[model samples]
Target: MRTPARRTAAALAALLLCLAAAPATHAASPHRHRAATLDDLARQHGRYFGSAVDNPELADTAYSDLLGSEFGQTTPGNGMKWDATEPRRGVFDFTAGDEIVNYAHAKGLKVRGHTLLWHSQLPNWLTSGTWTADELRAILKSHITQVVKHNRGKVFAWDVANEIMNEDGTYRQSIFYKTLGPGYVADALRWARAADPNVKLYLNDYNVEGLGAKSDAYYALIKQLKAEGVPVDGFGMQAHLALQHGFPNDVRGNIRRFADLGVDVAVTELDIRMILPADETELAQQADWYGKMTSACLAVRRCVGITLWGYSDGHSWIPSTFPGEGAALPWDENLGHKPAYDAIRNALTAARS
Candidate 1:
C-alpha cells in the first residue's frame, strides 16, 4: 500500500472521505424539524452528549424523567464502580448497575460503564485483605471479566481503569498498582476486552483535560499501550473544571494530541464548578467556558463524546467534596437552565453549520 502507485490511490481515498465527512454535518432523522435537544444536536455531528446519574437520583422521578429525555447516554456515577459491584471476593452485586443500565435502555439512552477499577471507593474486602501478587491479579481479573461479561451488550464503553496516575506524572500507588505493578493498567484493559470484545475500553482520569504533567503521562502511556498492541480504545478526560483554575490550556490541541495516539478522546465527567452563591458575572464566565469545552470536542474527529458528571446542581457532589464550592452544572437545583446550558446547546448546534 506504500508503493508509489498506491500513494495516489490513498490520496484520492482521503479526499473522498473528507468530502463525505463535511457538507452534511448533522444526522438526518424524522424529528429533524423539532427543537434540537443537546443529544440531538450532538448526534448531528456524530457524537453523544450524556450525563452521569446515581441510583438515588432515579428515585426523583422529576429529575430522572428529564435526564432520560435530555441526554443520549448515561454513566452511573457510582453504580458500576468496584465497591458497588464486588463487595466480597467472588461475590458480585449488580443491583445498582442493573438499575441504571435498564433505565438507560428503557429511555433509549446508551450507557458508558463508569469504571471497572479505580483507586478510591473500593470495597473493604479488597483494601483490607493482604494477598500475594498472584492472588490479587486473580481477584482483579475475575472482577473485570464478570462485570464486563454481565453487562456485555449493555454498555458502549468502560473506564477500564480510572485515576491511575498521580499529579506528578507517576502511577498512583493503588492496591492494584502496589500488588501487580505498573502492568496492572494494561492487564485490566485486556481482561475487560476479553470479556466484552465489543465494548470500548478506556483509561479515565481527572486533571488530564489540558497539556500538563498529568495529561502528558497518559499521552505517553497510551502511546506505549498502542505500540505494544494493548486493547485501549479511548482516553477519558474528566473535565472537572473550576473557575479558579482558569480554562485548560489549548484543550482542542490537547484532545488532538490524544487522537493522534490512535485512541478516541472523550470529555468524560465534565463540570465547571464555581464558588458558593454564584453571581451574574461568574455564571456568564462559566457559560463561555462550557461553550469552549463543547467546541473543542466538536473540533476533533476522534473525540467521540462528552458526559457531564451530573446534569443538575441539585444532585452535584461538589458541595460535599469541596467545602466552599458548588453550582457546577448546566442546570440549577430547580432544573432550571443556567446560562451554561444554553452555551453548550449553541456550541453543539453550531457544529452542524
Candidate 2:
C-alpha cells in the first residue's frame, strides 16, 4: 500500500526518465526560431555546409538529431564505397547506401556519393584476382555503372575516383591503373556519365589543399583530361590538416588555380587535428584556423562548399587513426560547441553581413 504523495513522486520520476531517453524534437521547441545553423548561414552565401556520416552513427539519436538540424548535405562515409556496395564481383548490395540516402531524404538534405572507384577498401574478389586489360575494364565499367545507376536520382554527385595520386604527383598504381593503364580513369568517368549524365563527377584526394607536388600532379592530369574531352566536373581537396604540420600554404590560390581549369573545387573532408591534451591556447589557434579555412572557400567563386569529415569529435576518425592526436571537430564528445564552432559561425556570419 503506497501513500498518494509517494505514488505521485514515483510517477514523476518515471516521466523525467522517459523524457531524458527521448531524442530532442527541436520542431516542437519554442526556441527553434532563434538559432542559425551552419547550413543556413552557408546557403546565404550560395554554398552548402555539410558533414560526413554512416549508418551506425544513426543509432546515436543525439548525433543524428544534431545532423538533421545543422547540415544541408551529407557524404556517406563508407556506405557507398566499393567494399560496401559491391562485395562480390558480379553481385551488388545497396542496403548500406540506401539507408543513408533514405535518412538524408527524410531530413530534407542532399546526398553526395563518396566513391565509385578507389585504390583501397576494394572487395577481395576484385583486388585478389588477376585480370587482363579487357577483363579489368569491363569489371570497372560494370561497377561504376551499377553503382551510379542505382543511386542516379538520389545522389547529386559522386567522388568518381578517390586518392588516385601519389605524394610525388604520380598516378597511383592501383589495380585499374596496372591492368587497364592510364586510360582507365577516362573509361571509368565515361561509364559513370553513361550511367547518369546529370550526376556531377569528381576526383577526390588529400594533401592537395596547398600548392605542392601532389596538387601539381592533379593540375596536369585535369588539364590533360579536359583537353581530351574527359568529363571531369570537380576537384576535391580533402583538407585533413594536422596542427602539428601547420596549415597548408596558399590554400585559396590552390583552389583558384584548379577552378580556373573549369572545375568546381570543394573542401571535401575538412578537419583540423591537434595534439592530445589540447590546452586553451592550442584550441584558440585551432579555432582561428577553422575560420580561415571557411573564409578561404568563400573567397573563391568556383569553390562550391565545405563538408566536415564529421561534425563532432566523438564521431571523428582521428583518435584511432592518428593515435595520440584527436579533438579534430567543431563539437566535442558531448556535442558541446568548442571554440572552433564559434570561430566557424563567426566566419560564416561575417560573410553574410
Candidate 3:
C-alpha cells in the first residue's frame, strides 16, 4: 500500500539497526573469557598444588599455571626417580626432572623432590642385576647426586623414603632392604643431605592416617629413628581416601601425634575417591570428609599444607587405579567446581581468617 520511496527508506533503516548490533552479538559469544590459569585458581583457593602430569602435551601449561600461580610448590612423581632419572647405570637422564624443576623455579614455586627411595618405580636393571653392596651404594649415591645437584637451590624438600610400611605392620620388603638392610634408609637420608644440605628431608607414605597397623609401624619406626638422631625432618601423609570406606576413625589425632614428633606434616597427594558417580549423599559425605581433613591440618601447627592429587576429576588417577570410580577431585573434568572443592576452600579460608 506504501509508495516505492517510503518502502526503500524503511528497509534502509532496518538494515542499519541490524549492522549496529552485529559487533555486540559477536562479543557476547561463549569463548570470550580467557581460560583460568593455575595462578588464578591458587589465588582463589589453593596453597599446595600438584598433578601427576602423565600427558606431555599439557605438562608445560599445567606446570606454569600451577607453579606460576599464587600457590607455589610442586612434588614430582616418577620423574625424579632411579628408573626415569637413570634408566641405565652410570647413564643419567634429567629430561623429565629438569622440566619439572625448571617450570617450578620459573613460576617462583618451591619444588619438593618426590622421593629418593621408593620400591615401586625402580628400574628393572637396578632390580634384576646382581651387584655387590659397595656397587649398589655407589649407584644409589650417583642417582641422588645427578638429580639433586641439577636443581640444587630450586629444590626445597625431598622425600627420603616412601611407603615402607605394609598394611600388616611389617616393613614391606623392598630391594633396598633386601640388599642393604634397614640401615639403608638412614644411609640414603645422610647421602641426600650431604649432597644438598639445605634441602629439607621427609618420609612419605600412605595409609598412615589413623591408628591402624600401618600407622603403628610408621610411629614405631620414626620413634626409633628419632632416638638414633636421624636427620629426618618431616612426614608426608598421602591421604588417598575414599568416601565409601568412611573417613579414618582418628585422622586428626594421628596428625597431631606426628606433629608432636617435633617434625612437620603435610597432606601430600590427597584425594577423596568416590566409588560411584557421586549422588547427593555421596557428595555430602565427601564434603564432610574434606572438612575433617582440613580441620585436622588447621589444628596442627606443623601441618604446613595440603595438596590435592589432581585439579579435576578427569585427570584423577582413581578411574585407572579403581575402575568405575572417577569423581575424586575438587573440579570435575570439564572444570566445573564441585562441592568437595567448595568445602575445602571454605574450611581453609575460615581457618586462615
Candidate 4:
C-alpha cells in the first residue's frame, strides 16, 4: 500500500495528464460576466470582502493597485502584533502599522487590527525574563491598553486574544496562561474594550472553522463571556485549508453557532493550499472550495466578511512555512486572477441575488 504522501503525488500526476488534454476556457465561466468587484457584490449582501497585507508589499506598485481596487477591507499581517508594536518593554511603536492604516484610509478601506495579544512572536524581553504573576498581569494590561489606544479610531476590529486553545479544547500553556490562568482571556478582552470602546474585539484561531473540540471550546468561552457582559464582539475563523485534508464539514453550521452567541463571525486569514506544480484538477477543486467558503459565510446573517490571508500566490507565506505546498491565494504569481477569484466573485454575486 502507498503511503499518504505517495498516494497524493500519484493522484496529482494523474490529474495533470487529464488537464493537458483539456481545452482552454474560463475556469468559472458562469459568473465571469459579473463585472462587479468583490467589494461591490459583498456590499449588496451587507458584507465586506477583504485581504491581509504586510508592510513590505506596499513597495510593489502593481500589488498595491490590485489590493486597493479588489477589496474593501485590509488587515496588517504583522504590523500590529505584540513584537511589531512593542519591540522593547514599555516602549511602543506604531510606525509600521500606521502606514497600513493610512493607506487603508486613502483607499477607503476598513482596517482590522491583526492581533493585540498572542502567545508567539513575543519580544525577547518579555519571554526571556521571569516575571511574577502580578508583574506579568500588569505588563499585559499596559500593552493591550497602549496598543489599542494608539489604533483606536484607525482600526475597526481587533483579534484580542489569538489561538488561546489547543485542538483538544485545552488551553495552550503559553506564558500568559502559565502566569494568569484562563482568566487572562476575559481580562485581555476587557482591557481592549476599555482602550477602544467602539472597536470590535475578537478571539481568533485557526482549525476552528468546523464543529470540533477546538471550536466547541470557543463556543463555551464566548457564551461565558457574553453572560458576564464582557465586550467580546466577534469570533474570527482563520480558515487555512489544505486540499489533502479536505474542507471543514458543515462550515455554515459552525459559523451559525457562533452567530447564535450574539457575536459576529468572519472568515479571517482564508487560504486554500495544494501541493506545488498545481494542475487543472487541483485548481478546479480549489475554486470550488473558495465558493463553498464564501457561500458558508453568506448563509449566516451575522457573518460580516471574508479576508484572504493574502490576495496573491506571489507573496503568500505558505511556501515558506509548509514547504512544497502553495498556490494558495486567488491570484497567481504574476498578479493575474486565478479560478478561485472568479469562484469567490460568483458566490458573492449569488449572495446578492
The TM-scores of all predictions, comma-separated, are: 0.90, 0.91, 0.83, 0.90
**Which residue runs does candidate 1 get wrong by more than 4 Å?**
1-33
Clashing pairs in 3: 38-65, 39-69
Better of 1 and 2 by lDDT: 1
Leading candidate by TM-score: 2
Q: Write the per-residue lDDT of candidate 2 for residues 1-353, one digit (tens) a residue.
A: 75799889999999999999998876668765659899999999999999999889999999998998899999999999999999998899999999999999999989999999999999999888989988888888899999999999999889999999999998899998888888888888889999999988899999999999999999999999999999999999889998999998699899999999999998899999999998898899899999999999998988899999999999999999999999999999999999999999999999888
Model 2 TM-score (2 dp): 0.91
RMSD of each: 14.5, 8.8, 7.5, 17.1
Sorted on lDDT, best first, the list reads 4, 1, 2, 3
TM-score order of candidates, best first? 2, 1, 4, 3
lDDT of 4 by residue, 57-121 (tens): 99988998889988999999999998999999999999999999999999999999989889999
lDDT of 2: 0.92
Model 3 regions lying over 4 Å from their true place: 1-70
Superposition-based RMSD of candidate 1 using all C-alpha atoms, in angstroms: 14.5
